[model samples]
Target: AQTVTQSQPEMSVQEAETVTLSCTYDTSESDYYLFWYKQPPSRQMILVIRQEAYKQQNATENRFSVNFQKAAKSFSLKISDSQLGDAAMYFCAYRSPGGTASKLTFGTGTRLQVTL
Candidate 1:
């Protein structure tokens, strides 16, 4: 069984600053996919970034990036130049690459608060 964990329940960062949200997962499968999803007050889960387990390079998208430590089963999200719009609940998720019916296992989200 695979499980994702987010130790931080909430986080705060000043505008234009940076923040890192920690996440870790336990999985026996060698091939899988990790993802970061953001849910704003609207409650819509939007994909932030994704990393393939077989890839060594960390995934990056604009101001969002991830530090994926495969050996440690850690996948942390880094938001650079954080903005007020970035305030949301961030969730780390995992999925097996095996079947089309595979479901995503998500972590307890970390709520991000951006201050001026």
Candidate 2:
């Protein structure tokens, strides 16, 4: 089992700017998958990016990228070129690829506000 924490409950960013949402997790497992998901007004769970705990390199998806610190159990999302469409509730989640592959632990959430 893992516990994910999102320190910032809300963050505001100007249009076309950049913003970073922080997330940290506590888990005893050595192998797992960390993820960043976006839920907009429509309430759609969108996969922003993901990282493997054993991988040293961070995971990136276009303007969405993660700063994954395995040792520190930190996985943060950096949104570049922020847009109106980016405003949403972001969640950091993790899932062990073992027998509990069906389970996913998610953080509270971080409300991102993209402004003009």
Candidate 3:
């Protein structure tokens, strides 16, 4: 069984600044994937970034990057030059590489409040 944990329930960031959201997980499997999904008030889950367990280098997408510490089982998301549009509920998720019933295990979620 795998589980994701977001220690911070809520976080706030100023526009044009940067913020790092912390996340940790527990899993027995070595092969899997970690992800960060941003869901605005609209409730649409947007894939922010993903990192494979075997990849030594972290994953990055534009202003979004991940600090993936495989040994520590910690995967955190860093948002650069935060914008008002970035305000949303961020969720950390995990998915096994292969399984008969593959499913994404998500964290409790962190509400991101963006201020000017």
Candidate 4:
């Protein structure tokens, strides 16, 4: 079974600072997809970033980026210039390609506390 892991249960960052959240996974499949989803206190899951297993280069989206080490089965999220709005529960998830409905296997979740 494929599984995502977020070691940090809680983290804090000051406004305007940068924070990196660590993630790791275990999978037997050759091809799969990884994603970082942010869930605010309201509980809506939003896609933060994604990385394909076949891609060697890391993926970045504006203030968000990923350090994906396929060999090590690690995928960490880096949030730059953090803001109060960035405070949320971040979840690391995985999905196998060509699977049913692209169901995501998510981690326990990391609660990010952004302070002013």
Candidate 5:
């Protein structure tokens, strides 16, 4: 079985600051996908970024980036230049891409608070 864990239940950052959310996983499978998703108050699940297991380079999207430690099975999200709009429930997710439905397994979630 595979499981994702977000140790931080909540985090806060000032506007234009930076924050890193920690995530760890346990998976025996060598091939899988890791993702960082954001859910605003509206509760729409949006993909912040994704990393493929076979990729050695971390993934980056705009202000979002990931530090993927494959040996440690850890995937962390770093949000630079955080803004009020970044406040949301961030979830670390996993999926076996070739599996049925590409079903996503989510972490407990880390709520990010952006302050002025």
Candidate 6:
């Protein structure tokens, strides 16, 4: 079984600062996909960034980046230049991307508050 974990249930950051949301997943599959999703008040799941298990390089998207430690089964999201708009519930998700319809495994999520 695969599972995602987010130890921090809540986080806060000042404007223009940086914040890192920790995530870890346990999976036996060698090839999979890791993702960070943001859901604001609108409740729309937005893809913040993604990492391919086989890729050695970490994934980054604009102000968002991830530190993927394959051996440790750790994947953390770093948000730079944080803005008020970044305040939302961030979830760490995993997908097998195989033939079977492996539904996404998501963490409990972490609520981020951007303070002025």
Task: Give the residue spans of candidate 1 off by over 4 A.
Answer: none
After the best TM-score superposition of candidate 5, give how far the Cα of residue 96 lies from its true spot, in angstroms.
1.2
Candidate 3 ranges with C-alpha deviation above 4 Å:
none
Relative to the true structure, candidate 4 reaches a TM of 0.96
Q: Assess candidate 3 and give its lDDT.
A: 0.96
lDDT (tens digit, per residue) of candidate 5 on 16-76: 9999999999988888999999999999999999999999999999999999999999999
- Among all windows of ten consecutive residues in candidate 4, which has the lowest summed lDDT? 94-103
| Cα RMSD, model 1 | 0.8
| Each prediction's TM-score versus the true structure | 0.97, 0.96, 0.97, 0.96, 0.97, 0.97
Model 2 stretches astray by more than 4 angstroms = none
- lDDT measured at residue 14 in model 1 versus the true structure, 0 to 100: 98
Worst 10 residues of 1 by lDDT: 94-103
Q: What pairs collide in candidate 2?
A: none
TM-score of 5: 0.97
On residues 4-116, what C-alpha lDDT tens digit does candidate 6 reach at each position? 99999999999999999999999888999999999999999999999999999999899999999999999999999999999999999999977884689999999999999
lDDT scores in order: 0.97, 0.92, 0.96, 0.94, 0.95, 0.95
lDDT, residue 110, candidate 3: 96
Better of 2 and 3 by lDDT: 3
Best by lDDT: 1
Who is ahead in lDDT, 1 or 4?
1
**What's the TM for model 3?**
0.97
Clashes of each: 0, 0, 0, 0, 0, 0
Alpha-carbon error at 62 in model 1, in Å? Answer: 0.3
lDDT string for model 2 (1-116, tens) is 57999999999999999999999999998989988999999999998888888899888899999898988989999999999999999999989887747478999999999999
Please give the lDDT score at residue 15 for candidate 4.
94
| Cα shift from native, residue 73, model 6 (Å) | 0.5
Q: How do the residues 16-106 of candidate 4 rate in per-residue lDDT, one tens digit apiece?
A: 9999999999998879999999999899999999999999999999999999999899999999999999999999999999748488999
